[model samples]
Target: MTTSENLTAPRRPRTVDEHRAFVASLLAPMPAVEVPISGALGRVLAADVVSAVALPPFDNSAMDGYAVLAADVAAASPDSPVTLPVPEDIPAGRTDVPTLRPGTAHRIMTGAPMPAGADAVVQVELTDGGVETVVVHGHPAAGQHVRRTGEDVTPGATVLTAGVVLGPPQIGLLAAVGLPTVAVRRRPRVLVLSTGSELVEPGSALAPGQIFESNGPMLAAAVADAGGEPELLRFVPDDVEVFAELLAEKAGGVDLILTSGGVSAGAYEVVKDALAGRGVEFVRVAMQPGGPQGAGRLDGDGPAVVTLPGNPVSSLVSFEVFVRPALRAAMGHPHPMRPVVSAALGEALVSPAEKRQFRRGVLDAADGTVHEVGAPASHLLASLALADCLIVVPEGVSAVDRGVDVEVWLLEA
Candidate 1:
């Protein structure tokens, strides 16, 4: 069944696939912008990056050596070296160059353009260290050690395709092509809100029944890691009117909104109370640690909102399972999901038959085994930090024993 179908039928817990597909339907790539190539790292390309100039641009020497006609050195050997006069030196960045004389050689440095009539370079290591007269001990084939023009890339070629994330390698290529800037999809701006009257900021002294607010910073960081710009709002009290007022006041100029806590069936669920029937759908997804979820666009032209459970692990898992892909989609990334691999479990573990379990795991790549990082409880925040992957268990299965193969989504990649 489709995700929208699942959301509309809230009686049954929706599968992870259904929820994710629904979330994907809510997002599109953000607008494009021309940014300096130097600042384009982690940005998504909006259009194919066509090269304006060829790599290497000209035929140049690949080593510090003598540039010569290959025929002149073809018969030379150590015992009978070819002795030729070096008329001039060619270093990198030299514009003025003279063609090689039939009977002579030129001292050349790496990256120096080859002179006319020179088809090969004999490295300095294979020649006598001479300036006026150089002795070449070895013969070189024609075109040896010469970097031909357009060898790496040609002008007007699509060097990078649209939707590719610009990393260090991509940035270097654009720089090599002499481009000062490139067109890329802008990172989505996300507003993160942690809701609850019982929440307090970290490092502040807490009163009775109060816990430090961790979801705001954690979700913000997750947003940043997913290539979205994040702004964390101060914690909101558990009152529907105040929550609605803040959302209305700050929802402008943002692409999306994320709220943690106040999304469950509790009496003081401010988010549900304020957003119910407004636009959002609260659903019980068939997943452990992140079953309670909500998503919808705001009234008029307001930003899309996603509500996650308040427990640290549940919120993070929800981000990984749903919000991350949505943010990546808005960035124009073609492949938004985490890399997955099949691995054997190191030990046995039990799970609820009705809910898909995403247990924190440490993958031993050396042995191709995965082990649970800590307890399966949703509040185990420290365990999430220790995990490198999420061990996925299907909903129909109640237990996964030692050495059982299962799907694992890598969090590190």
Candidate 2:
């Protein structure tokens, strides 16, 4: 179903694709803001960038040599060498224009503006490297070794288009075109909150029932790496009332609110309890490991919310499949998803009926195959850590023999 129908709690379970599309529609595109060229790296352009000044700016010397008229140096050779008086020395950045005297040469440096009457430059290596008088050994063609204005780029030319990510090269281009700043889509600010009374911070002594909390910091890191500004909110008491109050207090400041845990079927489902009637809709997606999903606005009006399952691997896989792409798209990213490839399975595997399976794997690139790294459980953090890609098994298929081709989602670019 379309998100415009309103993603309230669904009467039944939702498919993986259906829930993904719904979650993608949750976030509105961030507005554009002007920032300095130095601050534009890693940002996406919101508008086309046109050059105000032509590259090279003016006709300049392309080599450190002597500026001479092409006809003056045309007959110079070892057998009939021509000697010309050097009337002036023109270094790069010289302000006043010096016209090349009809038959005389002007010593010029690389990037120096071409003299008003010069049509070519003769290299110092070919001459005697003289400052006052120089002996030309070779002929120079017309317009040789001289940079022309508007050759590389012209004024009013579109150097960059909208939705292009600004990297070092792009930023350098903007600087070369004399733009001090540019307009780009602003990064989406996200507040990451994880719930559960049994969760405890790492590096501390834990009670008998408490395990170390990981989802908060991990998701925050993921959010930051995906080009979103992330703020971590942890250690709030796992009560429905406290959670509700915190949401109301912190909702208006950020673009998205991401919460993990307490959405599954359990006795202490705090997220499900607090946001059940408010606006967020929790549902089970027809997928492996990360089936329990939630999305919508808090109080039907506040910041967009997406709730994920508590297991470490499940949380990560859910983010990769849904949140990461959505967040990048919201920031105006051109290619929002990870690269995927097809490879043969190194070993046999089984998948549950009517559910898509995502298995951590290591790819044998030379062999054109992938092998599972860890079992299918959602809490297997070690396997996820060692994995370079995720092997995807589609729904409706239960088993596959060795060497069967499967879809692989590469983790790195």
Candidate 3:
């Protein structure tokens, strides 16, 4: 298309919100899969997990002490202790516990099953620490030092609701509930493709016009951090046929195909060239740093595609703004967007009148302000690394003064 044709095109640039929604619509929620509790970390549960057996399973001792009726030691004191004969020992996981008769004590260990007819436990410290004959110098109230059955969790109760992320505690809860495996939303497998003839792998000697490729590793990290499995396809040549062949070979194995670079109007725009009219839709989003974008499936049968800009900052910023949330939403995450807050700008800034600007910044949470980390240039990568948040400037507002509160997207750890 000629420049005049592009300028007099049928429609204007797509808005950021429109493009975000379009990209997100490409990947739907994945079906549930049963995974071992050992591998469920960071995965979202697709269904509510009900407790098969109550936590603790049965009434047990919460302390290493003697089990006795509260009334049996009611009259005991430091000056004059009550003596009782210990006839049984109850250790954790031991069955066949004998019922405690009145005026008799049973030596018990922490987590031991509670003996029948025992209402409380007098700690070993409060007694003479005797195994056969115990002296009770203090009284334990009824239910004290006892882990009652069904108190922590009840059978048939939902221990973890659907859409909850599985962390250490959640995994522990599942194991405690006797679930060796759990049904969770499978993590999206994403293929990251970085295209450029000028790109070379890191740790290699760069030729005159070649530069070390970083986008593939960067985007893959972002994908993994968003709870998706990432596979890297780096240093794709600028030739359309080569790129297309590589994509075809890898598309079937991934839920989504993410590419960095070659979506703009410039020469050798391999992503746009290879994917145009092949089911992917390319458009210039009305956003700074990441204006050129594309989202669709290859040949209508392959995996979804999301093409980002080449500049290091733009590539990462676009992923944070668009791709990450979409991948998360497709994984059944309830809140797909990053945590956003309003903070005053540490300094004044300017933005394009028709583009929403996402500038990297360091958020001063203590001061309730955000400072720009680097210049507005998308090629600045060091600033991107130093930034912990993105300061947003909406379109139609060209400038923001210092102390003016603006929306900020807080980057996760």
lDDT of 1 by residue, 277-391 (tens): 8788889899999999998888634678889999999999999999999889888887899999999999998999988899999999999999999998999899999999999
RMSD per model, one decimal:
3.3, 3.7, 2.3
What are the runs in model 2 whose C-alpha is more than 4 Å off? 1-12, 78-80
lDDT, residue 156, model 2: 92
Ranking by TM-score: 3, 1, 2
**Candidate 3 wrongly placed segments (more than 4 Å):** 1-7
Residue 116 of model 3: what lDDT? 97
> Which residue pairs collide in model 1, if any?
none
Candidate 3 C-alpha lDDT tens digits along 184-267: 998899999999999998999989999999999999999999989999998999999999899878988789999999999899
Could you tell me every candidate's TM-score relative to the true structure? 0.95, 0.93, 0.96
Better of 2 and 3 by TM-score: 3
Clashing pairs in 3: none
Alpha carbon lDDT at 334, candidate 3: 86
**Candidate 1 lowest-lDDT run of ten:** 296-305
- Per lDDT, the best of the predicted structures is 3
Candidate 2's residue-wise lDDT over 251-346, tens digit each?
A: 888989999998988888888999898888888899998999999987788788999998999999999999999999998898899899999999
